[model samples]
Target: MKRIMLIVSYNGANYCGWQKQNNAISIEEVINTKLKELLKEDICVIGASRTDAGVHAKGNVAVFDTETTIPPEKIAYALNARLPQDIRIQESREVRADFHPRYDKNNKKYSYRILNTKINVPIYNEYTMHASNYLDIELMKNAAQYIVGEHDFKSFCAANTGVKTTVREVYSLEITKNNNDIITIEITGNGFLYNMVRIIVGTLIQVGTGKIKPEYVAEIIAAKDRSKAGPTAKAKGLTLEEIYY
Candidate 1:
């Protein structure tokens, strides 16, 4: 058997999430179904991340072992022919037999987008979180500074997460705005707890809206209480931007 790694991207609006579920469709399920059809064997994909419902991905990674004679470099082209337009396999290659996408990830980057304008653009409605009010970009930037280091991110994670430790290292965090009134918050980290990116975006939005002081971010982190953080941002506005191994 040969292990093949695939780089994938998808618009998550139409699927439940990345993982296979009992009553819903998923990206992994679709990929596996197509792989089975193409290779004439049952296949299961191992994804780098289990992104939540409505969350998109630009550079998600997955791996599967197969015994087919097909070359690894041809897998992307073969899979793309079967995948829907909303999902695409960007690249594929053979990997060392022991390489596991999730366990071997060196870092991951996520980005959350906000449409901070009076009117929402029809074209981008599915991709951005619309906020009618003007946001204080400076305050959001200030709040982001507090998140750029190793910390126990209990306040930012979803309650009931099975992980025993909430500590993660934030390599970088930045907020930027464009002329089209689109605000993007990009964060790179060693790892993230469940719902961590959405919570961070929500807290930053509170800071931008003056509901929370920028300095309070540090306090919230120190408190290690979920209730102290802002609400979780909408999943549709969040995307897994990249993964490094």
Candidate 2:
């Protein structure tokens, strides 16, 4: 059997999440179902990240082993025919047998989008978080700087994750606003705990709205207490922008 890697992109509005679950339809379940129909073999894909429900992805990665004679490069085209319009395989290729999408990942970047406007645009509502207040981008940037480098991110992580360690290294965090009144917060790191990115965005939003000073972010990080951080941002605003392996 040959191991195949697939780069997947999807609009997560319709699915429960990336992982399969008995109670809800999920991206992983849909992909696996399509693969089975296309190759006529039962298959399941191992995804790099289990993105939260309603969270979109532009370049998520997954791998599956199959005994089909289909060309690896053409798998994407073939799979697209079977997948729903919301999900598409951007690229596919052969990989070493031992290469795993999750464990072999180098780093990942996620972007949280906020539509800072008095009137919410229906077209952009599915992917962007709507914030009515005027956000001070400069203040948000200043707070984001304190989040860079190694630190205990317990405050930013969702509770009940069961992760042994909360310490993680953040390579970069940036906030930018476009002319369309859309604000984007992009962050890159080696790994992340559950809801980590959303929490960070929530905390930054607090700073932008003057709920907290930029320098106060340092105290929150040092506290390592989840209660000290801001509320978790909505999942629909977050997108897995890219994955580096």
Candidate 3:
């Protein structure tokens, strides 16, 4: 059997999450079902990242072993024909049979989008978080700088994540606003704990609103207490932007 790696993109609005679950549809379940139909074999894909429900992905990776004679490069087109419009296989290629997408990952980048408007913009509601308060991007950027290097990210992780360790390395963090007033917070890191990105964004929002000073972020990180940070941002605003191997 040969392992094929697939680059998947999906709109997470209709699925429970990337992982399969009983009594609910998921991006993974759908992909598995479609692959089974296409290859006439039970195919299960191991995703590089198990993104949470309502979290979209632009370049999530997955790998599955198959015995079919189909060309690797053409699998994307064949799979797209079977997948729903909301989920597309961007690319497919052969990989070493031992390559594990999750374990082989180098780093990933996530983007949290905020629609900074007094009134909700219905058109962008599904993908962007609507924020009524004015967020000072410059202050947010200043706060982001404090967490740029390797450190224990316990303050940004979920309260009960149950991970083996809370330490992680953040390569970069950027908060920017476009002309349309949509604020985008992009963070790149070696790995992330559950809800880490969301918590960081929430804490940065506090700084933007003058509730927390930019320089105070260093203290929050040093505290390493979940309660010391701001509220976790909603999942809808967060997207798995890219994964690098």
lDDT of 1 by residue, 13-51 (tens): 999999999999999999999999999999999999988
Give TM per candidate: 0.98, 0.99, 0.98
Residue 81 miss distance in model 2 (angstroms): 1.2
Clashing pairs in 3: none
lDDT (Cα, tens digit) per residue for candidate 2, span 66-112: 99999999999999999999999999999999999998857999999
Candidate 1, residue 124: lDDT: 85
Candidate RMSDs in Å, in order, are: 0.7, 0.7, 0.8
Task: Quote the lDDT for 48 in model 2.
Answer: 96
- Give the TM-score (vs. native) of candidate 3: 0.98
How does residue 68 of candidate 2 score in lDDT? 94
In candidate 2, stretches whose alpha carbon ends up further than 4 angstroms from where it belongs are none
